[model samples]
Target: MENSIYQVYEDEIQSLEEEIKMLAEKYEDSQQESTFFSDEEILMSMKSFQTEFQGELKGQESPSDLKAQLESLEADLSFLMKFTGIWFTSHSKKTVEKTGSRTIQKHRLSGNCHSLPFQLEFQLLEIKSKESVSAVITDLNVIMESGEYSGVSKFVSSTEEHGNLLPFFKSLSSYAEWYEHRRCTFLHFKTRYPDIVKLPEGLLGDYIVLRNPEPSGFELMIVWKIHVDEDGRTTPVLDLLTKVPEQVLEQNITTIENAPTCFRSMLLLFGIETAIENLIKVVGLKK
Candidate 1:
């Protein structure tokens, strides 16, 4: 039949999309697994910094020469991303040196946390004495897409309080990882069951509705959310919601009412993907 042939093409296209998505996810995971720069690039940048610092210590160059060297060093450092899943592509800095061998610098850093982009603006005041160097960060600010960072206001507040960006980057990376997983999961199901799965908010949504292929079955919804705590811990939360007609509920009140609870139990027994697959099967769908 013409309908059957069309479905065959659709299924093939879905298969190709899944393959591409798999390759993309692998690339992203590799990026998270390794630093942006190779070992050689990092070593070169570090050695360059050493050379610049040594030149500064020589005390033989003019102030202009020192400034030029420092500027060069900063530029080099800006390109080298040494942290895993965290890298600054560009930055701006203003440095002030005091008579007591102390220096104060203000830095504005623009970077990405894995695939999630963020811009960090902060002032770093570094004080150098004969024996030691001390640093303080102030006027901390973060700019990110408001939608991407909806639930993590407390994380920002805590990061500002502690003047630490490491925790924030780590949390952001983990959160983004979970976020991608949810997105891809929804996409996979929506594509696989195009007639049965409906997304109210497109692919970026937090939930998917699974309708029965036949008219006799009730509708099931899966809600997936990624949670980030103040301590930089990330968790994925999933729940099931259902809507059944009055006739169906009257015929099977216990099953209709207990679907959510049963789903939670299934989630505990089996993982999320498996639980979702089982739930779909239970909805009287062929797949």
Candidate 2:
């Protein structure tokens, strides 16, 4: 009976080892893909696994033996989770200057891909109890630049709803990653065909003005609008403007079908591949 019990424990451990190895390999493979599991999901899974393992080992092995095995597994899990592409896993936390009797904690996560860089910040108000704590996404900015085409886009959460910091952090981190991926794709295209593709210039506020090469002295303006629903879901709306009244009258300034090939390609980089369709649907643009 003693030998059989030991064999069972050994078999369970071996099975867990195999599972961990498979997860690690999947994590590695996902890095090269466009879509992968979010960091929050992966971390939560690791935590759940840890809890289950602890419960399974309790009363099954000597206290010392359980502690040693738990520590080993935890260390391995931590290492794996760090490389799972979650920005929060590598975030930095610092205490900001106190305001009156309230203390503030600032956590920041930042990353860049080539010329595109992004930063997400969370400001937490520390209280006496964890339940009284509150956090908000203070800043979310992504800057993309290639030659004369450079713009800084910022994300603003509409509602002032404050709650646990973990969910907010996860959402912002995921947004930053998505922004980076979109920027990287845009940069790749811009780099490959520099002469053919030119970035819009004179970007001010939420609008970009591009000098139309074909029409000589004509400029195309692109406007950006972000809509945040009650549920905190964000949708991007794009609009186009032109100084020439005749183009508007003709209803053919820059329809998706009639847009410059390079311009159309650049719009795909903005995380809105169907920008023209969105502009038409949302803004009621004809043609």
Candidate 3:
């Protein structure tokens, strides 16, 4: 009789244990279901909260006070970012402008083939964060001035290359490797008056070079090693090997990097703040 009672107790305890496990699994599933939030919903919530908060803030403070508060908020936002600033571009103007011209002429086997020479110029405007650098390229309309090209202007990349041609030909990869092999660091500007060649100051690494000059320009290659300072200035380690002339540039060259650079792509993959943070850390800057 005692044995039978003990057996009954054991069976009851086992049943209870199984029940507890099932309950735990069910609770976990429910929690997971409840925790999942769609991106759209999250964005909507943020917008709603911002609107409501702004409404509540509006008449509660004077105009000057509000302005001061907004400025403070902006400063706080900036401080929260990891890295901010733009690096002036470094380029080798010779090989690009020259190579582009030679390639075009060489490919023009037929009498009807025309050689349209163009130039691309770049200026780093604002480094919103490590990842996103906002820049303005002038003279975007000159690509289709001559030759059999009709819609050449529209066929350019945002970074200012000859549309898909460079990638199609794999010229970019080749040029990047070539530049790296030569230990080149700066982008050489082989133009007339402003013969400024941009160079980086910190440890140089392989980088994609994008070009967008006013009118139209072919995308050429540029390799740079970038660094950012505490004062927010981007310093690049200069490539001491490459050199160009200060003389008048009479060569009609057409080379540009119309595709976006590696830096820009990184921004797209990660948040701007996150990208800058990585860049800052890489450059040996403090948080």
Candidate 4:
């Protein structure tokens, strides 16, 4: 009876082990199905990511094309600028030309003649030269008949008797230095500027140089005057004088009331201000 009980108990224990193995296999299979679905979701996410990436790439392509076009246009503009010598505007060019022409006319009409009508102080009008230096000299002549000598003078043509006297006047070339440095030429100023003299006919000052004093130059004093008729036609007269007043040297005055703006600008640019300041200090302190 005890041996039969042991056999029945062993069979019951073996059956229970088999049932536990079956339950474990079913749980593992269910876990595997859930894992497969999770993998599928991850794959879908990867596809959506790739689609978004492709859209962004397509959008960037259009902007890249636009950027390339802009670059090409800028290059063309640069090339065109180089090809054309004109970098400024047409309006600017016109304005500059007009201003330049007006300045030239102004200077031509009221330019400085070699001689000042009055005396200048502390400044020398003497010209230093080696050759038969024909000095472009100016002298003050009074405005009156040939016999009467008083008042300012005006422009007058050279007469046959006074032919030899014309040579004494310095060549325009010497005075040309003054004009060349300023980029200007002498315009028979008598015709343009009437205020230089006060006369109706014939010039008052003798624009002549002395020839007898060979190789040396002399300064002639002259006064300026103007003469006008009933009509607008004007005549400039100059009177050649023998001597200028000693007191004239005490004060120097310029007939050209103003300086050119271009010259003024250049002076400012070329450190003239500093030089002037230094000069003032030296002169003021030295005394």
> Model 3 Cα displacement at 281 (Å)?
27
lDDT values, one for every candidate: 0.76, 0.47, 0.34, 0.32
Candidate 4 lDDT over residue span 1-287, tens digit each: 99889989998888877766655644654464334345578567545755555546653555445546866986986676445321211110011111211211011011122322111111112333465423322231211232322211222222112332233122222222232321221123333332232223334232321111222222232333334322212333333333223343223223112212332444456543332223223222321
> Per-residue lDDT tens digits of candidate 2, residues 170-193?
434454454454455335434643
Q: On a 0 to 1 TM-score scale, where does candidate 1 land against the true structure?
A: 0.66
Clashes of each: 0, 0, 31, 44
Error of 4 at 47 (Å): 32
Worst 10 residues of 4 by lDDT: 100-109
Measured against the true structure, the TM-scores of the candidates, in listed sequence, are 0.66, 0.35, 0.20, 0.14
**lDDT-based ranking:** 1, 2, 3, 4
> For residues 122-164, what per-residue lDDT tens digits would candidate 1 score against the true structure?
8777777788888877778877785656767777778878877
Candidate 2 clash pair list: none
Model 4 clash number: 44
Question: TM-score order of candidates, best first?
Answer: 1, 2, 3, 4
lDDT of 3 by residue, 1-287 (tens): 99999999999999889778766755664575346567698668656755556645555664456556867986875564312211112222111111211211011111111122333343222324456544333323223232322223233343244223323123322332333432432222222212122223221323332232322322223343333222223333322111112221123211112122434555568844344334323222211
Model 1 steric clash total: 0
